[model samples]
Target chain A: MSLLAAGGLAVGYRRGRRAPLTLVADVDLSLAAGELVCLVGPNGAGKSTLLRTLAGLQRPLAGRVTLAGADLHAMDARERAQRLATVWTGPVEVGLMAARELVALGRHPHTGWSGRLRAADEAAIDAALAAVDAAELAWQPVDQLSDGQRQKINIARALAQEPQLLLLDEPAAWLDLARRAEIMALLQRLARQQGCAVLLSSHDLELALRHADRLWLMSGDGTLRAGAPEDLALGGALSTAFRSAGLHYDALEGKFVSLQPRSGGPTVALHGSGTAASWTRRALERGGYRVCEPGCERAARAAVKVLQQGWELRLGSSRRRCESLESLLSALAAAPVD
Target chain B: MIRAQWRWPGATLLPGRLHSDPLQRQRLRRALLQGGLLCLVLALFLLSLMLGSVNIPPDEVLRSLSRAGAGESAWERIVLLIRLPKALTALLAGAALGVSGLLMQTLFRNPLAGPYVLGISSGASLGVALVLLGAGGTLGVTLVAGLGLGGSLALAGAAMTGAALVLLLVLLVARAVGSNMTLLVLGVMLGFLTSALVSMLLYFSVPEQVQAYVNWSFGSFGTVSWRELRVMAPLLLAGLTLAALLAKPLDALLPGEQVAQGLGLNVRRARLQVMLATAVLAGTVTAFCGPVGFLGIAVPHLCRSLAGTSCHRTLLPACMLCGAALALVAALVAELPGSNLVLPLNAVMALLGAPVVIHVLLRRRNLRRVFAS
Candidate 1:
């Protein structure tokens, strides 16, 4: 079984002569075969560092990483290459190379001393291009591709390695929304069809949550939380991990939503049930107004709720005209404080 | 499905289409073609020995070859003493420099990088200058010139040292400057600085010493003696072999350092090997020939264009053949009978190389567009 595991992994960098700024602290994670994991974090939360370390491009100051029962640090470069493949977000400067040639580079570990690609190597390259839907662009120079298309080709190159563990650093960073979905779908499909353990870092939390089999959430407080996406989302770990103040975690929608303030002045006769009215009442309060029930003196001065058209302003209500929910709130704020 | 099979010739099989797979067949065909070309180069090299200032009849040349002293007096001396050794030196040096230039270009990932561009030639010049200028008076002119023998060896060592130093600096600068063009400019500046130092030495040296230095700088294949060839030949062979061995790893490096490393090549070791091989090849040729120009830089580009692929497997041997042929042609032109005074080899190369370089630069855009199309 192919498995990727990291234990007590600590990564840090020194800016100058001062104490080192820790990026990932005592993190432990494991990904099994046929599993796809998405790593999400805020800026400077060590997501990229973690990916780099796992890819063997960066050495961890402490702790160890292992791939499929092999110690990553101890394996020879060729053996390690045969087991793992990584794609980073950087421009490969050899501009005129064809897409197929780029993918064939993945077979470097398998080729002999002469590096003559065999028939099997060619077949593997073709399979990789097809897997990523890049077969049509095989003969085209990668420089000619759009950013999104190039990203797919890069992924195809990694896939051609036929590695058990695939690590990608921000694969979706340059892609548009639809292309991003397509790439994510491809990654998921690869994990399932080929039984490759895939781990990718991304800023697109909603897509990651929806698609990934597992999530590694790097909390702002130097902690890494790992579980199924739904488990972490239900545990209040995602909202806390993202720490976006303007957003609230919606259990029903299984996503974050922007809490917009109610606009109309605090003049309304509430006739709805507790659930709807409570939400409306909370929204109104957050918009800076007092909620009044039906037939109170404050409610009398406020507007009456019409059958189909919602609320309209009545008598003296703080010199505010309640036209719609949005305008009324601004009007109330503009009125003289009496 | 039929269209797909035809479009991707190697990917899928077409019914009743019995052609051998093109890519594999083409690779074999190219291999055979390169082998044939190498044989042709050998034959032409032997033929060059027959055509020189004093044209020896092919039959007489063969007679002299069978028994050194049996042919006509002048023909015997010419074939034995002059033509054979000179042709051999030219072929070996050409092959070495061609391979050297190819290695440096691939390692640096720059089309312009070569022995001359990286200041290895300048280091050799410095060694020659020390021997020619510093030791000229105490040691007579011939003795001082003979010091060139030792001077060249030392120069090869020094050039290797200089190459390593520049390589280290480029690697360091590469970290700071993200652009390949910037690294190329830095390498060129290094070359200029070394050349400037050589020029200052030239200005201060005596007239006799200056003449000796000038001859050395003009470069010739006739300078390597039988004794020197014993030492030089093996070194050139070894260096070229090392470069050929590095073909696969070098191709991997073309994409980028990270990708190459990920492909399981020890990037640091591979780079060092390439640098050392280039130094030996360039250093030996420069020591013997007085810093031959254009062959090392332009020959690889010519091979790449002809082969239509940057894959080192084809490019390296192609470069070696092309370089040997070009150098032999230059040597032949220099030895033309009308000019009893031999033309400098570098001047002949510039006549051929400069125009190609200009043409490459002029048509670069159109070429790239055509390749893309």
Candidate 2:
């Protein structure tokens, strides 16, 4: 079933007599149950704002968000809460509650006005904790946990709600590389196993590309592009979304690489393939020499050169002498004053 | 570790495992234990009524209780009239302050946020100062005392107004600065400003009026008349009931306002309701009991420590009961070594409450670890 549908959505914020900051513009998207989508965008690209609006945390300046054919705007807060759960970034202060107790708060909607946890509620909490591998930490205080562990507990808390849709704003912001992977894997598992429609905003483009079932690309110009990860990557959307000055995408390598400057120095031959040329090129640059055609002049008197897998040095009116890069550096430093 | 194993009746135990089922059972047991604590507090409240100045036997106390006018002696009249009202007022006032503190702390997402932290009590003090010191006469004194109660209530209204004003400021600042700590410091500064204004009013008052104000400031439950109780009781009950109704939303709020809104609570309305409830509670208690200190800030933390949970479902009631118990105990102690020499209830509460506040601060590191994200 289609869990959420946003039609002709537009969001903007007005700041004290200034022009409105337009975030999302005329976006249409539909998310189905058991689908995991990652929203990737640069800072201030409106990913967080879109997620908040979808979760009903923020009202859209103009848009219609419907869950299961019912307009979200028409639903009361409590009714909307029954279908959606969110895990927001930043510290949560709930006094001295234990992890399990915190997770049980997810059952607020299902529980009675008194908020008594039934046996079914207890089972759900246990299942959620166990699903997130946080069962052992249930009795531990939430404030005592590591950041990564706390993030997992928060996810577990959301899972305990058993909502149809889950929205997370930068859930992996504080996690290390390994923990980040673990959290992504956990989210994927939740989407598959629990049949939840999950949408999370993250800055980890590479990880999101690898793990997310679909990608929602929020551009700097207030537009959203949604498609499969491979489709986006192949279509150049990924590169375009993250483009900045001096950084170019390598389609074959699937990563960014810095363009190397040409070397300029005295005529010298170098014999090396990939590794040797790369290392020597780096060394020459560090020594303030640039690589160029052999006959090119304008090389400084102090410039060092490498040719045919060997270093060459030519002082004023002196013949070029071959030496290792280390010896060449030492020779330049130790040379007699002219 | 004391790994005490408590078995629920007719439940099968799985050997060599953590017994996940047992954990659920343990929670149920813990809830029952909290219930027992509440019952124990009720018993203590009854016991408090029996101990007093005159050597009226327990039987005579019970007899006086069973029949209203049968024991029309001065001793019975004093016990029924004076001490009972005072003790009950202390209980209600303390409970109100405790709930107010809990609500404020939860709403602001700060452990230190309370009636005093928000300057609500100080606002009440300012109102009392205007009544007692601003205008001076014996007739003015009677009028101020009457108006003082109403003025203190107005002070509470003013406090709510101040809180709303500050909330607007904080929200604007939060958008501009995007810093939580700065907003907290701003609240503290607002509170300081109100207190400074109250002190200025106190400085210009006449000595006799100052003495009366000072006595009220010391905090006592002995001043509530039956008539005042009639007004105070319903207000406290109604405010507390409203607060209790907010428990679920308030629990969502603890995670932060944004989270609460995402959970489908109108954060603005919830916050306003909480502020109004807290103002009514703290204001009414201060009006009747003369700005009693510490209970509004301390009891919530004490309940959290005892119950090991922050879910308002348990924390609200636990705080209410514990606050009443603490106040009742304090009242009993105030009346001890003979009821004639009553110590100010505020002094006793401070002696008890200050250490708990310091302890919460000292153990904040551990608390942060427990709730860290």
Best by TM-score: 2
> Candidate 1 has which clashing residue pairs, if any?
A263-A325, A263-A326, A264-A325
- lDDT by residue (tens digit), candidate 2, A1-338: 57799889997776668876779889999999999999988788888888878887667878799998999878888777788889987646555768897898788777877678899998999999998999999988777778788889888888887889999999988778998989999999999998999999997877898889999999777889999988888888877877743345566766654444534543333334566566766666566454544444554444445466576666666645655767765676566644
Off by over 4 Å in 1: A14-19, A95-98, A135-150, A234-236, A243-338, B1-20, B32-47, B57-59, B66-69, B144-197, B357-373
- What is the CAPRI rating of model 2's predicted complex? acceptable
DockQ of each: 0.29, 0.41
lDDT by residue (B1-373, candidate 1, tens digit) is 8776565553356333333544554465567668876887877776777887777667887788887464368778788778887888888888888888888777777666776655667766766676666655655366545554654555445434554555556556655764445655776787787778778877887788888778778888876667667777898899889988998898888777777878888887787677668877887788677789788888877666555566787888888887787788778777774346688888987886779766864655323421231
| Alpha carbon deviation, residue A288, candidate 1 (Å) | 19
User: Could you tell me how far off, in angstroms, the CA of residue B359 lies in candidate 2 after the best superposition?
Assistant: 6.0
Model 1: per-residue Cα lDDT over A68-118, one tens digit each = 777888889998889898887655655345678778888889899998888
